[model samples]
Each structure stands twice: as C-alpha cells, then as structure tokens.
Target chain A: MVKSIHIEKLNYVYQSGTPFSRRALTDVSLDIKTGSYTAIIGHTGSGKSTLLQHLNGLLKPTSGSLTVAGNHITSETKNKELNELRHHVGFVFQFPEAQLFEETVLKDIAFAPKNFGKSDEEAEQVAAKMATLVGLPDSVLDSSPFELSGGQMRRVAIAGVLAMEPQILVLDEPTAGLDPKGRLEMMEMFEQLHQEQHLTIILVTHQMNDVANYADHVVVMENGGLIANSTPERVFSDPDWLHKHHLGLPQTTAFAAKLAKQGVPFETLPLTEKQLAEKLAELMPQSGGELHG
Target chain B: MVVPFVYAFNILNLYFFMFRIMVLLILKTKFERERTMDGIIDIKDLCFRYSQENEKLDLSHVDLHVNEGEWLAVIGHNGSGKSTLAKAIDGLIEPESGEIFVDGQKLTEESLWNIRKKIGMVFQNPDNQFVGADVEGDVAFGLENQGIEREEMHIRVKEALQVVNMQDFAKHEPVRLSGGQKQRVAIAGVLALRPKIVIFDESTSMLDPEGRMQIISLIKQMNREEGFTVISITHDIDEASLADRVVVVDDGKIMGDSLPEELFQKGNELIDLGLDVPYPQRLKFELNKRGIQTPSEYMDEGSMVNWLSRSILKN
Candidate 1:
C-alpha cells in the first residue's frame, strides 16, 4: 500500500494571541495508509474539520511537517504548483454538489477540467465519462443541474471531483443528512472506488455503522486532540473508551456487548448483523424454539 | 323627552358591554394558547406553492395535527415537502388553499406575528439562521426583534444558554463553536423567546452522526423537562424512530403516519421509498422470515433483545 498522506506534529490555532485564541488542532501526527479506506469520527468542534482542511493544503499548519505524494505540503511551495498538488489530492467539500453553478449538468461537470486548461472537447469528454462513473444518467448531462433531484445533484458534484482523478480522495460528511439508504449507497460507491481504482480514501463521518462495515482505519478526535486511532473492532470493543469521548459503537455492537456481559461464550465481538446471528446461534440450544412476542 | 333619552342611553350601554366582552375573550385566548398551553397547530387540506414555482408544489391536501408538548417527526426522501411544510407553518410561505390555525387563528399576515409568537423555527443550515456574526448576538437577535425588554432579554438569553449547557459561550464568536455547539446556540435563540413550540427543520442534518446524536439528545432532554412541542423535519428515519410518531411523506403526500413499527412492517415499501427501515425493524423483519414469531412491536434495541431472550427462554 502507498503512504498517500503523512502528517508530523501538525498544529493549527485560530486567532492566535487574541482574546479568542483557540487551539483547533495540537501536535497531530498520523499516517493514512495509501489505498486504505479511513473514517474520521468526532463530535463537532473536535478539530475533525480543521484536520480535514489541513489535508488538502486549504489550511496551513502552524507547525509540523506534512508529506503528501512526495510533496512537502507544509513548506511554502510555489502558488502555481500548489494548485497542481490539489489536483492530485481532490477534496469534495460537504454538499459540494449543491454549489454547482452551470446551465447544464454537463457544463457543471466540465468546469473543473476546463479550469485546468483541458480543451472544451477534451473536458466534456472527461466530464461525460466521470458523470457515468458517479452513476448519473446520460440524459442528465444536458439537463439543468438545479432541476435534478437532490440525490442526483449530489452525484453530479461528486462526478466533478472525480473528473480531477486524484490519487487521494477526501470527502467531508458525504452522508450527513441523507436517508439511511442514500447513505449506504454513497458508502457503496466509496467502497467500489477504493477496491477497483485502489484510490486512497479519507472519509469523515459520524456514523459508527459505516466505519464498522467499511473503514480500515478509524480516527477519533475530541476537543482539538486525537483520542484514539485503531481498527473498528479494537476501538468498538472498548465501550468505555468510546463512551468517554462522546462516541458510541454501532447499535449491534452495543447489543453484542450486552450479550457478552450475560456470560455468553462468544467467539469474537460481532460488528455486523451476520456476525451477531452466527454468534448467537452457537450459544443458544440447537433445538431453537419459535421466537414469540 | 326624558323617557326617550333614557331608552337610547340604555341601548348604548348594553352595546358597549358586549363589545368589551368579545375583546377580552379574544385577548385571553391569544395569551393562553401561546404560553405553556398545548394543541397549538391544527392544519387541514393544506396545499402550498410558491407563486414563482406555482407549478412545482407537490404538497397537496396535506393533513396534519400536532398537539401541544408532543414530538412528531416528519421524514422522507429529499424534496418530500417536509421543510416546505415547516416554512408554511412559520408563515415563511403561505399555503395556496389550506387553512392553518395557530392557537385558533387563521394563517394571515395580520395574524402571522401572533402565529410566529407561538412557534420558533431552527433551519437546516446553522450559518443561514444566524442573524449576528457573534454567538451572543446571534442568540439575542430573535429576542430583540420580539421587542423583549432589555433586562428581560438579558435574563432570557442567560436562561436559554443555561438550558442548552452553552452558558460559557455567550461572548464567543459563532465561527469558534463547532457545528453541534453552533446548533445549540441556534436552539438557545429559539428557546429564549419561550415559544410554545420549537420546530427543528433538519437542524442536525449538516452534522456528523456524533453531532447529530448530541443535538437529538439535547432536544429529547428539553422535551422531557421544558415541555415544548418538538416538530422535527428530517430525512434520517433512524433519528425519526425516536419520535412520538413517525409520518412518512412520499411524493407530495404522506403515505403512512403511525408508530415506527407500522411503517417498518411495510418493509419493502419503506425501502422503496428510500428509508433504511431502522435496525430493530430490520432485525425483526429478518427474524420473521426465519419463522420467528416476534412480538407485535419491539420498542427499541434493548427491548428487542430482552424480548428475544425471554421468548427463547420461555420456549
């Protein structure tokens, strides 16, 4: 796996030295293993957003080094080339698609590549291809971006980012307000991209269920500091650790914990529905009676 | 001449008394219905559309009844008119034909302030709702507009902050607070007015699940203590599952309005409508497929597990 994102002792403070000075991030150091799907979980004001901003050079750290794609992002690089790095490290801001301003979805999708000096014909070609990749229908290309459904519009926004074809893709709260199915759909898309393209993914989400199913790495933050960084199973098993940070495991995980406390001899912690079924079946009597109300 | 004058005087006195009684009753109803009293909103056949987008209104013949001190969650896919209906109640937009009464007054600009007096709304985007750049200022903006006296304003602002556990942030800049904290400030602003109903219109939609939980739990606590009517407009059914009653809106009409279990029983339909059919519901649904006769309804995760354990043990 490639080490796509590397941060060393990163620090960021808002309004430093002023009466309102706030340390948004302090001594943050972490490496996002290249090609691994990661989920960053934290309550708001927990420096999750601040950390996200730092990943793409949108916000410079007050101190420490960041090595991304062999580029020293923390160093005062040339302005022209910073844009170049951003192209490779594509970031889709929360509800990014809602900010689309174009006469047609096709035009909106092509806007990014056009800014990068791709010819009109070449940009449209790339946009068309990216549009399909994000699951937007071909007919939507000529349709007004604003006229499409909210879900469709969101896909178009993601397609705009996909047009950039960055090695590392960072999405901030992609499923914040979506319904459960829409959220799952978005996760499926992310999983597919990571599995097929081997694109390094940095997902910032609050849903433990999502992290439980897809994330290879889980980063927990609280009050401007990293609290825990580990795999889902290890972190979720320690209910006390998660509870201390205002985090809760998936409902299923919590249920499994309850069973474990009842002196059930579970082989391992169950994080998914299937695991829960298998674990419970093993403990219960073979002649399972019909479950009643 | 004296007899004729006396008759006229008697008639005039009777008319004046009747007028005063009518005025007193109206004023009395206005104050009581707004202050800590219940059954605030009664809406029927409500269909609203923007004049600019007249052809676009999907909410037609909508019927909803919300009681005082009750929490009702309206959920659906995007563009389901949940937000639009909320705005209509707030008088942000008027329904074309439907009549909405806040404390028994028809929806009209003349009665808008009085209606708004009964309810305060918190929108989806915390940034859009802030009237001031700073935290205290943002919270105070609504109170100031309502012409609350300065001293009373100070007292209420502090009270609202104390309620949401955001008292220490009275002077902090809005940008300094996290999204959840910012929403807490937003809720405080609405709370300061002491409105009978505080409508949260997807207020936590922009937050992470952790922040979403914080916001919802805060509202739940407030509902238990303060007894305000909570009407939440959301797309997340899981969050909606915690409400008193779940109303599923599809297309432009409500397809189902019942307890969470009733809608969940319509399993595939709920899924087709783009709802996740909550965790406990999903578990029960799968169990039923496996020939398990679960109870009529399982209230929550803990209860579901408890019921399963008991049933298995009994059997």
Candidate 2:
C-alpha cells in the first residue's frame, strides 16, 4: 500500500529558544497507509494533537521531517510553499462548529473552496455536493448555520473541509459532545467515505469503542513520545500495559477480560461487540436455555 | 389576700407552661414536613422559551424533583432542553411560568443570590471558568466573592484543593495544568463554596477518557462521602449509568425517569431518542440472537460477568 503520511524522528517544542521552552513531541516516527483507518489514543498533553498539527503544516517540526500526501515538509519549509499541501489534507478540528460564521450553511461550506481559488459557481456546486454527502438536507442549505442544532452545525463544518476535496481526512475527536445517535451517524458517514472514496482516515479520539470498531491501526502516545504502533488487536492484547498507561479497553474487550477471569478461554481477544458475541456463542453449549428475567 | 394572690400566680404559670409545649410540637412537625415532603431542588410546571416565534417552548411544563443527597443525571439530545432546565435551577434564565426552589428557597429576583449561594455549578469549558492565575487563587475566587475573611478563605481553599486531590498543584498556573487537572481545579473552586447542591453541566464532556474517569470518580466521591446533591447534565451514558437516578428529557419535556438499570432496559427506545444504550444491553441482544440466553433485566458489567460465569462457563 502507498504511504499517505510518513514521519521520521519528528520533534516539536513550544517556545523552543526561550526560557519557558517545552517539548511536545519527541523522536516520533510513524507511517499511515493510504486508504487505512488509524486511531491516535493518548491522555491530554501526550503529543497527539501536536503530531496532528504537524500534518497540515499548522506547526512545523523543530527537527526531523514529515511527508503528508506526497508533500515533503521539513523544519526549514517556507510557509508559502505549504499551501498546496493544505489542499490535500482536510483537517476537521475538535468542535469544528466553533469555526462556522456564515450567513447560510451553503455559504459556510463553500468558503474553503472559494478560498482555494474556485469560482463562485464552482465553489457552490462543490459545497452542495459535500453538504449532501455529509447528510445535510437541501432545505437547510439556505438557512443560517447558527440557527441549526449543534449536530447540524458540525456537519456543515465537516462539509466545508470535505469541499476542499482532500485525500486524507484527519478528525480530532469528531464526536466529542454529540449524543449517541449523532456520534453513530458521524462515524458511519466517515466509514462510508472510507469505503466509497478510499480516503485515508486519521482519528484522534478518547473513545476506545470507536478505535476498536473503525481503526485497523492504533498508535498510543504518552508524555511526548510514541509508545506503541500496531494493529488494534496487538495494541489491546496487553490489558496490563493499557491499564498502566491509564488507557482503557473497548467495552467488549474489558468484558471479555472478566470472562477470562471466570476461566473462559480466549484464543484471541475480541475487539468489538460482534466479535465478543460470536466468540461466546462458539464457546457455549449448543443447547442454550431460555432467558430468565 | 396573700394566699389568693399566690394561687392566681400558680395558675398563670401552669397556663404559660402548656402554651410552650403546644408551640414546640407545632414547630417540630413543620420542620419534619418540609424535610420529607419537598426535594432539595424542586421545579413545578416550569416553562421557558428563547423566542416567541418558536412553536415549542425550550423547556415546557417540566416538573422535576431532586432529592437531597441524590445524584440525578439529566440526559437528552442537543436542543432537548436539559441544559435549559439546569440553567433555570441556577436562575441563569428566568422561566416564563412555574417555580423553582433550591434548598427550599424559591427562585426569584429577591432570592436569586441566596439560592445561588446554596448551589455550585461547574460548566463544560474549564478554561472559560478559570478566574485566577494560579490554582489556589482560582479556588479562592468564590470565597473572596462573598467577602469571606482572609483566614477563613485560606483554610477553605486548602480544604477544597485537598478534596479534589489538587493540593499539590496549588501554585501551578492554569496554563500549566492538563484538561483533567484544570477540571479538578474547577471542581475545587466549587467545593470551596460549600454549596448544598452541585451541578455539573457537561463538565466531563471536554475531557479525554482518563480525565473523564478522574472527574467522574471525584464526582462519585463528592456525592457519596460529602453528601452533596448532584445534578449532572450530560450526553455520556457511562456517566449517567453511575448516577442514582436518570431523567430522560425530550422536546422540552420529561420523557422517562427511573433508576439507571431500569432506564437502560428500553435499549432500542433509548437509541431512537438519540441516547446511548448500555453495553451490557447491547451484548445481551447480540447473545440472544446467537441462541444464547441472557437475563432480560439490565445487568451491569460486573453482574453480567457473574451471570455468564455461572450459566455458560459452569456448563
């Protein structure tokens, strides 16, 4: 598979030369394959957000190098030279709705495309398409973005990013404050995009369930360093390691651990609800009793 | 004449003694009635609207009663008026009709500040609420507001910090703290006021999972050990599950009110209402579909484990 993003020994420091210098990322090197779903899990101040900012040239590495969507970025890279790279990486910030400030939802979604030098007609067309893709109704297109509910406003923000037509979709806790139904819808829409458009997804989330369900690859960060980069199965296999880092397992895996304590054998850890159910069904006796109240 | 006067004096003393006994009995019953009949926080026929043009009220005829020392979680989808109801309790917004009482004091212009002093609220954004440069200063801000004495404020701030386990970060700048640490400071600030009721308005929503867990555990400790009446407005099911009672609000009305265990049994209905179904319920549905029988009642993770161990593993 082609690499969508590659980082080699990336380091970032806040206020580097000054007396109040702080290191945010240290010796971080990782690669995300094109058309793959990757989840970044970490506690706050764990350098995940810093690494994400590095992807879109929002912050340049203090040392080392990175290449996102085939655009090479180094510490010495000029700001003017990174504009082209920005078009290929759609960054959906945490609480992206906070950025919405337009007369209409259509106008808000079209803003990015217009900024990227598309004509009015072209930008509006792309905005309409992206808005529909994000499940926004046609009737809401002309309404004020501020008038919409929190979930709809969020979709408008995401549609704005999608209007840019990026190959890599980077999400920062996209479901942060949404209700469960809204969270599920947002995630499913991303899954559809991943399947239909083959866009590479890089998600930073605190929800382990999302990581288990959507992400094939998991990266665990801690205290300004990348600690683990592996498949979800391998990452979640060590309960003790995860517990020690104050990380949590998916609800399914945590439940499976309880069953393990009760002498249930697991050839492999189940990472999702469906996987756990199937595993338990295979283990139970063929003749199951009726459910009791 | 002296004997007659003495007899009159004795009779007057007996009458006074009987009146005193009658007054004490009446007062005792009134106190008990107030304590037992009314909740610590009570809302009666509360109605509110942001604008008259809107067809529906933001909060319509909502009636809720939060018991003293009860942890009640209010959950709803966005625009469902859960937050509105909470704000009404805090007198942040006046309801168009109906009444709200906190600690038995009616929510009115005259009693608003006194009611506020009895309630402490922790908002979602920690950074927005940080008023002081350092942790200690921020914790003491509330105390300093009511013109608390310097010596008393010092003792209270230290005690509040200790309760939230942020005593070590007393001198740390607000910018230096992580999201969790900042929330702890926010919580410490609330604790310093020593309010009878604490409202967490999506306080843990902005935090990461670990940070969220820390705050949730702290909330539990505050509710259980400190005996604070907790009203947490949230969308997180995990947070709601830990509460003593769950109140479901929909379209500016109370939809359902029950214990966490019972509330989750209506699994698909909850999902339809934009709320999360509990993990155990989901697992139960999956298991039942696979020809495996599980209990119909909602079982928390621990109970589910024990049942599965006894039923399936034992075989």
Candidate 3:
C-alpha cells in the first residue's frame, strides 16, 4: 500500500537558537498507510502536537525529512510549495470553534475554498455540500457563527477545512469537550468520511476508547520519540508497556484482562463491551436456559 | 410613702431583667437555625437570562441544594446551562428571579462579597485564569485580593500549594508548566481562598488523560479528605462516575438527579440527554442483552469483573 505520510528521523526544535531552545521531537520515524485511520496517543508534552504540525507542512523539520502526498519536506524546504501541500492536507486544531471567525457559517465554510482560488459561486456550492456532510442543516448556513452552539460552531469550523477537499484529514482532539453523543457522532462521521472518500485520517487524542474503536493503526509517542507503531490490538495487548509509558487500555480490555486473571476462558482481549458480552455468552452452556430475563 | 416608691422601683427592675433574658434566648435560637440548615448552598427557583428583553431564560426555574462536603457532579451538554448555574453560585451572575443562600446567608448584592469568600471557582482554561507569572504568584493572587497580611498570605499560599501537590513548583513560570500543572496552580489559587464550596467548570476538559486523572484525583482529595463542597460542571463520564451525586442538566432545567450508579443505569436515556453511561454500566447492559445476568450495581471495572467471574464465569 502507498504511504500517505512518511517520516524519517524527524526532529523539531522550538526556538532553535538562544537560551530557551528545546527539542520537541527527536529521531522520530513512522509511516501512515494510505486511507488508514491512525490515532496518536501520548501524554501532554510528549511531542505529539509538534509531530502533527509537520504532517501538513505547517512546521519544517529541524533536521530529518517528511514526505506527504509525494512531496518531500526538509529543513531547507521553502514556503513556495507549502500552500500546495496544505491544500491536500487539512489540519484541524483542538478547540476548532476558536478558528471560526467568519460572519456566517456559510462564509466560514467557503473561506478556505475561496482562498484556494475557487470562484464565489463555486466556493458557496462546495460549502453548502460540506455543511450537509457535517450534518448541519441549511437553516444554520445563514446564521452567524457566533450564534450557533459550541458543537455547531465546531462543525462549521470543520466544514471550513473539508471545503478545501483535502485527501488527508488531520484532527487534534476533535471531540475533546463535546458531550458523549456529540463525541460518538463526530467519530462516526470521521469514520464515514474515511470509508466513503478513502481519506487518510490521522487523529491525535487521549481517548483510548476512540483509539480502540476507530483506529486501524496506533502510534504511541513518548518524550520526543516514537515508542510504538502497530495495530491497536497489538499495542493494547501489552498492558505493562502501556502502564510504563503512563497510558492505559480501553475499559473493556482492562476488564477482560481482570476476568482472564480470574481463570475465565478468554483467548483474546476484548476491545469493546459488545465483544466482551459475546465472548461471555459463548462460555455459557448451549443446552441450558438463559442467564437473564 | 417611701416604702411604696421602693416597691414600684423593684417591680420595674424585675420586668426589665426578664425582657433581656428573652432577647438572649431568641438570638441563640437564630444562631442554631443558621448552623442547622440542611444545605450549605441552597438555590430556589433560580431563573436568569443574558438580557431582560430575551424571551428565553438561560437558566430556568432551577432548584438545587448542595449538602456540605458532598461532591456533586453536574453533567450537561454544551449550552445546557450548567456553567450558568456555576456562575450564579459564584455570584458572577445574579438570577433574575430567585434566591441563593450560601452557608446560611442569603445571596444578594449586599452579601455577594461575603458569599464570594465562601465559594471559589476554577474555570476551564488554565491559561486564561492565570493572572500571575509564576505558580506562587498565581496562588497568592486570591489572598492578595482580600488584603490579607503578607505573613498570612504566605502561610495560606504554602498550604494551598501543598494541598494540590504543587509546592515545589512555586517558582516555575506559568508558561513553562504543562496543562495539568497549570490547572493545579489554578486549583491552588482557588484553595487559597479557603472557600467552603469549590466549583470546577470543565477544568479537566482540555487536559490529556494523565492530566485529567491527576485533576480528578486532586478533586477527590479536596472533597473527601478536606471536606470541601464540590460542584464540578463537566461532560466527562469518568469524572461524573466518581461523584457522590450526579445532576443532569438539559435545556436550562434539571433533568435528573441521582446517585452515579442509578443515573447511568438509564443508559439510553442518558445518551439521549447527550451524556454518557460509564464503561462498566455499558458493559453490564451489553452483558444483559447477551443473556448474561449482571447486576446494575456493578458500575466499576473491578466490581464488574468480579461479579462476572463469580456468577457467570464460575462454570
């Protein structure tokens, strides 16, 4: 499979010169397969954010190299081609509602496309489609962005990025402060986008459940370096390693591990509650009565 | 004639003495009533709106009673008026038609100064609340506002920092601290006020898991060990699960109030309310759906696993 993002010995330094220079990422290398849903998990100050900024050419690598959509970015890479690179990689920051500054939701969604040289009619058409794609009604398109709810504002901000029609979508904690329903809906929408559009989705989050449920690949970061890059099941299978790195397993997996310790017949760790229930039901006697009403 | 005058004077003195004793007894009863109130913070028929002309109230006819030293978690979606309730309690905004009593004193414009002294609030963004350059400076900011003596301020600042486990980071600049550490400093600042009630308005929402855990543990310590009344406004199910009571807010009204275990049992109802059922509860629901009997009381991972192993998996 073609790699959507490739990093080789990537290093990023904050304020790289005088007294306050700090190395944010060091000797980090990873590859995200095309159309894969990748989740980056780590503690704060582990250089996850720094690494994310490198994906869309927002931040130049201090030493190593990054290749995104066949464009190679290095320390000496100029700003000339960054605009082209950004057009293909949409970046959504945390608290994206703060990014919505347009007068109306429609205008906000249309802003990105207009900047990319789309005509007024064309931009509005794309924005209208993006609004529906994000589950917003046509009624809210004309309303001021500030008048909308936090979730609506977030969707508008996201639609703004989606209007650019990027192939690879990068989100940083997209559902951080949303309610449970909103969080679930947002993740499901991203999953849908990934499936239908074949968009490569890279999400940075601390939500282990999301990582377990949505991520095809998991990348664990620790103190300026890539510690593990593998399937979510493999990464979560080693509880001790996760613990040593100050991380935790999804709740169902942790519970399953406890059951296994108590001598329950379990071959694989269950990642979700439904899986756990199915596994338990299989252990019951097939000829007997039901366990509950 | 002189004997009759003396008798009259003595009778007057006796009456005066009786009146004084009655007054003292009434004052004593009033003081006892103040001390014996059921709730430390009592809100009645609270209604508020941003403007009088606005037809809809931001908080509508809400009533709440927070028992002293109890950790009450307020769960709601965005624009659900949970934060509005917090602000009203903190005296940052006054209700349009209602009464609030904090520590047996009615909350009014005249009493706001005193009420504020008993209630401290920690907002969502740590950076926005940090008014000082360093940890100690931020923690002492609240004390300095009350015109406390320098010696007393230093003592309180040290005590507050110790409570949040940020004593060693007193000299660290706010910008240099992690999101968790900055929030700890914010909590320390609130603690320095020595308030009876501390309201956390989505304080852990922006933090990573480790930071969120640290803040939750700190909140638990403040509620349990220190016996501070806690009202945490949040959408985090994990945080709400640890509370003594959970209050669901929706559309500017109180939707439900119950213990965390009981509230989460209505799993689909909670999800419809834009709230999450905790993982253990969800697991129990799934197990029940799969024809495995799991008790509703198994709301935590350890207990759920224990119950499943002993009852269902024992075969």
Candidate 4:
C-alpha cells in the first residue's frame, strides 16, 4: 500500500543549543496511509503541532527522516527541495483567517497558485472553483476579505490553501472559534473534499467529536512523544486510558461507557450515538412495547 | 450657664449625625431594592448601527434583563448581534436608541465611568487583552487604573489570582503560558476589580477542549460561589447548557428565550437557525425517530445511560 507520509525516528528541538532549548518531538515515527483521514489528539504542550509542521517540511527534523508524497525530507535536505515538497502538502495553521491580506477574497485565494507558477487566468479559475468548494458565494468573491464575517473569512483562507490542489492537506484546529453551524459546515466540507477528491487529510484538534465523526485513524501524542496509533474506535474504547492522559472521549462513547457501567451488555464498545442506539434496540424485546410506560 | 450651653451644642451635633446616618441608610437600601427589582442589567428598546453606510441595524429594539447572580448565555451565529449586546452592556458602544440601566443607573456618557466599574469584560482573544508583562502585572493593571493604593492593589491581585487558581503562575509571561492559563490570568484581572457583572465574549472559543472546560467551570464557580452575574456570549452549545437561561439571537433580534432544554427541544429549528443541540438531546431525538422510546428526562448522557440500562436492558 502506498504511504502518504512515513517518518522514521523523527526528532525535533526548539531553540536548539540555547538555555531554553526543549525537545518538542522525541523519536516520533508514524505512517499515514494514502487517502486516509487522520486526527491527532493531545493536550497542551504535546508534540502534535511539531509533528504536523514536519509533514509539509515546514519544520526540519533534528534527526531521522520523513518522506511526504515521494519527497524524502531529512535535516540535510536542501531548502529548494523542501519547497517542492511543500507544494504537495498544504498546511493550514491555526486561525488561518489571520493570514488573509489581499484586498479582495478572490485575490487572496489566488495568491498561492500564482506564486506556485500558475498564470493569472489559471490561478483565478482555480481560486473561483475552490471558493465554491468551500461554500462561498460568487457574490462575495470580489468583496474585501476584511469585510466578511469570521466564518466567511476562514473559508476564504481555506480556499487559498485548497487552490494549491495539494495531495496531502494538514490542518491545525480548522474549526476553532467558529460557531456551531460554521464548525459543522467546515468539517463537512473537509470530509467531502477528502472523499470526493481522495485527498490525504490530517487534522490536529482537541475535539473528540470531530475525531469520531471524521477520522478513520487516530494518533495520540503526549509529552513530545507518539503514545498510541490506532483506529478511533480502539483509541476511544478504553475510558480509563483516555482519562489518564487528560483526554476526553467523544460524548457518544462516554455515554456508552456509562451504560456499560450500569450493566448494559455490549459485545463491543460503540463509538457513535447511532451505534449505541442500534445496539440498545437489538437488546430490546421484540414486542416493540414501550418499556417506560 | 456655660455648662448648659456646651450640653446643648453636643445634643445638636448628635441629632445632625443621627439624621445623616438615617438618610444614608435609606438611600443605600433604596438602591439595593431598585437593583433587585429591575435586574442588575435592564435593556429596553435597545438599538444600534455600526454606521450610516450600513443598511441594517446591528441591534434593534432589543430588550433583555439579567438578574443578579444569574448565569445568562447569549448564543448566535456570526453577525447575529450578540457581541454588540455585550459591548452595549459594558458601555463600550453607545446604542442608537435605547436605555441600559446597570445597577439602577442609566448608561450614558456621563455615567460611563461608574457603569464600567460594575461590568467587566473579557474579550475572545486572550492575547488582545493582555497588556502587562507578566500575569501578576496584568492582574494588577486594572486596579492601577482605578488609582488603588499600592498595598491594596497587591492584596486584590493576589486574591484574584487565587480565585482563578493561577496564584503559582503570577510571574509567568503571557507568551509562555498556555491558552488556558492566559485566559485564567485575564479572568483574574477582571476578578480583581470585583465587578458585579462579568461578560465573556466568546472567551473560550479559541481554547482547546481542556482549556474550554477549565474556563467554563471557573465561570460557573464565579456565578454560583461568588454571586457575580454572568453574561457569556458564545457559539458553544455545551457551554450554554450550563447557564440558568439561554437567549438565542438572530438578525439582531431575540429569536428565542427559554431554558436550554426547552430551546433544544426545537431541535431542527435550532439547527436551521445555525445553532446546535446538545449531543444527548440529539441522540434522544434520533432514538425516537428510530421507533425507540427514550425517557423524557434524558437530557444528558448519564441519565440516558441510566435509562437505557434499567428500562431497555431489563426487557
């Protein structure tokens, strides 16, 4: 099977050689399958952000190597080669809307493509398509990005990155600070992009619901190290382990655990509300009578 | 004769002093009565517009009443005028046509100073509100503006930090602290002033899950334990569930005002308004749709779990 990202013994240090030097990632190694949706979860001071920066060659490893989309990135890799790798992996930082600078929304979205060598017409075309994909109306494309609401500006910024058409998309808390509806819309957009475009998506968030809803694979990070790499079901099935790490289970899984504690029988833990409901229905008597009456 | 004259003078002084004390006591109780009767914050026919160029009013003929020590949550989508309401209450912006009575005093330019003292605001971005070099410094900045005595400022700052459970990180710089810690310090700054009302304007939106939880618990404690009225303007449904009252704002109007459970009972309607129902509430709805009968009181996960274990599993 093809791998979207493969890291071997990767280590990263911030402010290396200074008195304040700290190891952000220690011998972290993981493999991301091509076209898979991955969510990285951790508390503050965890190395999730550091590891994400390495996916797109934004941060060079102090040791070990990372291969992203066919480009091998190591401490010794040239800057020119790293830039080439970045084009294949688009990175969206936290509060990406803060990065918007162009006068018009269309211009901002087209900036990256034009910088990557697309013609003005070609870049604008790609930008317009991306804007539509992110659920922005055509009427707002010409308006000043600053004039748009926070959620709209966020979409415009996302469109800017999507216009690059990267095979691998890495987002850091893409839905942070958005309203509930906006949050759902943003996640759904990314899910659609991943499914329809067959893109490899890596999301870094503290929200377990987002993980349970979208992520097929889960990577748990703690204390600058990779702790667990498994499916979301496996990662969240054990409540004690998650709580020990200061992590919370998705509400559905937590509810399932609560039911289990009260002597509800389940062959396997359910990771979603629908699953729990289905399991409960199966345990009910076939008479279809209301139990509470 | 001289002794008799001195006795009369003393008696007159005592009478005047007693009269003054009585008047002061009456005024104080009258003020308290007004505050308790009308609500700590009373808004009537409130209207505001960003500028003449803007076609629609940001807030229009809105009426809201926040009782003392009540936790009121304001929820809405972006551009829904929730933030404008917060700003208006804090005296940061003047409403085009409305009257805001904070602590029984009408909000006006002349009364802004006294009104500001009653309401403390914590904005969305933690970085924007941090004006000091360190946590301790930041907490003390508010007191310094009020010209509090040096020794008294130190006492209040320490007390505030203790309230937010950040007493140990007093010297930490804003840059070094986590998002949660910075927000705690910001809250500490507000607490030092001892404001009667605290407005949280999406303060937890930028934090991670743990951070958000920390701030939420702190807000709850402030309302329940300290008796400070809270007005939290947010988009988070879980946070709104903790409030005593939830007000939904849409298009600069009060769309719905009710208990969180009642509001969420209109599940799809809320979703259509760009709001979300709590997970347990949504799950109950889904189960009902699938022909399963969930207990009506299952508004949270624990209760739902209990019901499922006892009722469905027993059968």
Deviation in angstroms for A275 in model 2?
0.3
Q: What is the lDDT of residue B39 in candidate 2?
A: 90
DockQ each candidate and list the results.
0.32, 0.66, 0.51, 0.54
Model 4 / residue A79 / CA error / Å: 1.1
Best by TM-score: 2
Please write out the lDDT profile of model 2 over residues A77-120, one tens digit for every residue.
Answer: 99998999999999999899999999999999999999999999
For all candidates in order, the CA lDDT equals: 0.80, 0.92, 0.88, 0.89
Could you give the candidate ranking by TM-score, starting with the highest? Answer: 2, 4, 3, 1
Superposition error at B178 for model 2 (Å): 2.0
List, in order, the clash count of every candidate structure.
2, 0, 0, 0
Per-residue accuracy of model 1 over A119-201 as CA lDDT, tens digit each: 99999999999888888889879999988877788898888888878889998888766766677788898888899888899
Assess every candidate by TM-score: 0.86, 0.94, 0.92, 0.92
Candidate 1 stretches with Cα past 4 Å from truth are A9-27, A60-63, A74-76, A222-225, A288-293, B1-39, B51-56, B208-211, B221-224, B236-239, B272-275, B285-296, B310-315
Candidate 3 lDDT (Cα, 0 to 1): 0.88
Off by over 4 Å in 2: A289-293, B1-34
Among the numbered candidates, top lDDT falls to 2
lDDT of 2 by residue, B1-315 (tens): 799999999999999999999999999999998895699988999999998898889998988998998999998887788889888999999799999988878899999999998899998988899999899999999999899999999999999999999999999999989898999999999999999999999999888777898999999999999999999998778889889999989999999999988888898888765568888889989988888887666788889888877777666
Model 2 alpha-carbon miss at residue B212, Å: 1.6
> Which candidate has the highest DockQ of all?
2
Model 3: chain A TM-score against the true structure: 0.96
**Each candidate's fnat, in order?**
0.41, 0.86, 0.75, 0.62
Off by over 4 Å in 3: A286-293, B1-34, B296-299
